[model samples]
Target: MFNELLKERLLDAHLEFFRKDKKKFLIHRILYAVIVAMLYAMVIMVIKMPIWLIGFPAAFFIGWKFAYLKLLSTKKNIDIKNSFLFPQFLQSFIALLPSSGNVYQTLKATLNYTPDPLDKELIKLIQKIENGNDRNAYLAFADYIGSSEAYMVMNMIYQFSEQGVEKESIQELERYIQNLQENKVDELIQHKMNASDKFGLFPILISLFLVIGFAGVIFMHYMTNVTDALNTMPK
Candidate 1:
């Protein structure tokens, strides 16, 4: 089902952060829901409301938290995949291509110097090659990245490996890398603007909430005074 697929993806997204202990992860999630529900139940009891009302907000809050964590993990993965490392990776690949004897050697040389998740991916690609899955390895690397630009780069490399590198092909690959770098710069600027907007909005929201709280307190004091005055008057 669609929901099952979504849940699988969400779990996979957090795999690095949470590790592979499903039982531990489930226990933590359950504790989160239980603690949230208990807090909401306490608030409802204080307000002299029916206990059933607590269940709604508790369930809603748990769903919201799950969605928030899922989104956070997804953004983290995107940041890792689209890191400045990619530009460095492309540059290194291009540089190595000229001196390395073949695509595998070029990739192996690049792997020695590459970082983190990209290095992890290259390891998988190398394993696939060792297992005689060269064709699938290229496609798998593209899928692992989930990037159109990555797919293009991988495909280009595969073509070069098959038909031998051509001047025109290398030139085209360079142009793609240049465009990718430009896109990354634009994305970075947009991220900064978004962060600035969030920072700016937070203070305004906090101030508005504080003003409303103060007004509520003053209104309550005024109403209490009026009631006391009326009780002592001609009534």
Candidate 2:
């Protein structure tokens, strides 16, 4: 079950760059996780902290989270690549629609022009079309893109071919897609800024909490000592 989940994550992340070394990748991640847990356990032991009380689980959780961070970073990179290429790919498809006059033909013509990741998916889509699925293949391709804007663009392309929409409308959609790409870029930047701020704030929050906790402990100890002294002296 865990292996299946990992496989699904790899696929979702579109880490085709790691296709050849998937087993090695899995092995390395597992080893890294184990090493992290072991090092943490040793740290706890050196500090004389009891492992039976939450130490081991915390170490494992830390290790798992750190390993998963690698996956998250890889997915972010792939997503960025796709976002950068998608607008251009859409324009290429739109350009060919007049010549090809059908969605499948337009995509086949666009395949050579398409870049990596998108090209790979295009190849699959073409195969699905050849397999007799027709419109279903096209609709599924939209969903497979895993982007809402991409889905809309693809569906619009299909509608254009089916309904024979005006060239000006196609050109307008092209402009809209270009603007969409620009907006997506701005949104990505904003999200990154928000993430940076959160990450920046997290350490400060942790530090403040730690300081308060230590101060509370010291204050309690001091108050207890004072109370004992007062009790002995007067009463």
Candidate 3:
């Protein structure tokens, strides 16, 4: 009924932004949920009710954990947001390239204008370029960005840095970065839409759970009354 992929992202995140003991907390939640499920089953058995009845309460308890997934998506959204800064950095690098001696210098100068994550990456990039590692520096930068468009932009920069490459490469990089920016916008929009759809399903799930719980209580009461009446008549 909902996207399981989002839940996987939360597991991947490990709740880094929220807790230092994330792994322990995650372990606790999982073990606790499992314990709760088993405890509910035992309760139903003791009450002489159908074991299948455990599914409703367990589903309600565990399913609301989708909320935990929603919180972790915040970290993922922030990561996707950092993707936008790459095009901005590309634009700056292209603009500074004309007066700069090489890609190393352009990357160094861009550091003055860059922000977090990208700025941090550029610092590493500049170090690698200074160490006489040109190709892999750009490659590592692209890998850090982790997208097809990112690899394309890094390749454009690699070409633009060559001694005899055409000046037209600058314009090409500019147009490509523009398109990349537009695509990133679309991606962010789609991401939010998917989250919205997931959130909308929760209310319906909650209502269904409440109805099942009410039915369970009524069933328990009826069985209790029937047992009492039979005991009075026979004994």
Candidate 4:
């Protein structure tokens, strides 16, 4: 019961870090840590090691895993913000612009279907535009996301707002933005493939090590028994 509550609290804290829903990821991380700690404790108990020996390493492992999970989650969030979602956003914005005829109307129409983090940022930008703070809105958005794709999108919007919408230029920019997004997606896919390969090898390596270790222990035991039987034989 106590562990369950602690896990819930940790997940809640993690959820607070992102504008989007990360509860599922947080729960998975917390559960992973707990299971790992429990296995560590079980190993120590089986080895007849002092219970106190489990505390420090278990705590450290939990903390390390949590930090790792946080790092991965943050990277995934950045990827989604800059690469995955932004391209779709740009496409939508570009498509809506020719019809909506203005940055504000385009953003407002896009917001109706946009998801969180992006949606929230768009809301802020819309508010800033409404209050006649276009400069600050652009700056705030660029700084908040700190994504190159976001910067490009914002620049495109700024240009459209100033120079009037040109369909050809907008289409060209959209295609370029989409290409960048595709490249990013490719890089991410390659990274995941590499990681999968590494993970695949890891289990095999661990199994080999365990087998060798257990075999050594059995061999040593067998030799000891043989030596004792020889010594006890009639001579």
lDDT of 4 by residue, 1-235 (tens): 2353345445454355454467565566677777777777777788888665648566646754664465546745764564556667777887788889788889899997777667887798898888884666776776666677677668778777768888788878878877866887897799899989999999999999999999999999999999999999999
Using all chains and alpha carbons, the TM-scores for the candidates as numbered come to 0.79, 0.60, 0.61, 0.65
Which is superior by TM-score, 2 or 3? 3
lDDT of 2 by residue, 1-235 (tens): 2463345555433445445356666676678778878887777778887654466766666565555566666656767778778887887877887888677788899998998887887898889867764666666666556688877777776676567768787888988887987987888899899999999999999999999999999999999999999989954
What are the per-residue Cα lDDT tens digits for candidate 1 across 13-131? 45554354767666666777777777777777888888578376756467446643664666566656556677778878888888997788888899977888678878988877777
Pairs in steric clash, model 4:
none
Q: Estimate, for each residue in 34-126, the C-alpha lDDT of model 3 and write its tens digit.
A: 676777677778888795784867554674464465555765664565688887888788788878767778889999978886788789888
Q: Evaluate model 2: give its TM-score.
A: 0.60
> Candidate 3: global Cα-lDDT?
0.74
Top-scoring candidate (lDDT):
1
Model 4 score (lDDT): 0.73
Q: What lDDT does the true structure give each of the candidates? A: 0.76, 0.74, 0.74, 0.73
Location of the lowest summed lDDT over 10 successive residues in candidate 1? 1-10
Candidate 4 matches the true fold with a TM-score of: 0.65
Superposed model 4: Cα runs more than 4 Å off: 1-72, 75-82, 230-235
**Clashing residue pairs, candidate 2?**
none
| RMSD in angstroms between candidate 1 and the native structure over all alpha carbons | 3.9
Off by over 4 Å in 1: 1-28, 43-57, 60-68, 71-80
How many clashing residue pairs, candidate 1? 0
Order the numbered candidates by TM-score, best leading.
1, 4, 3, 2
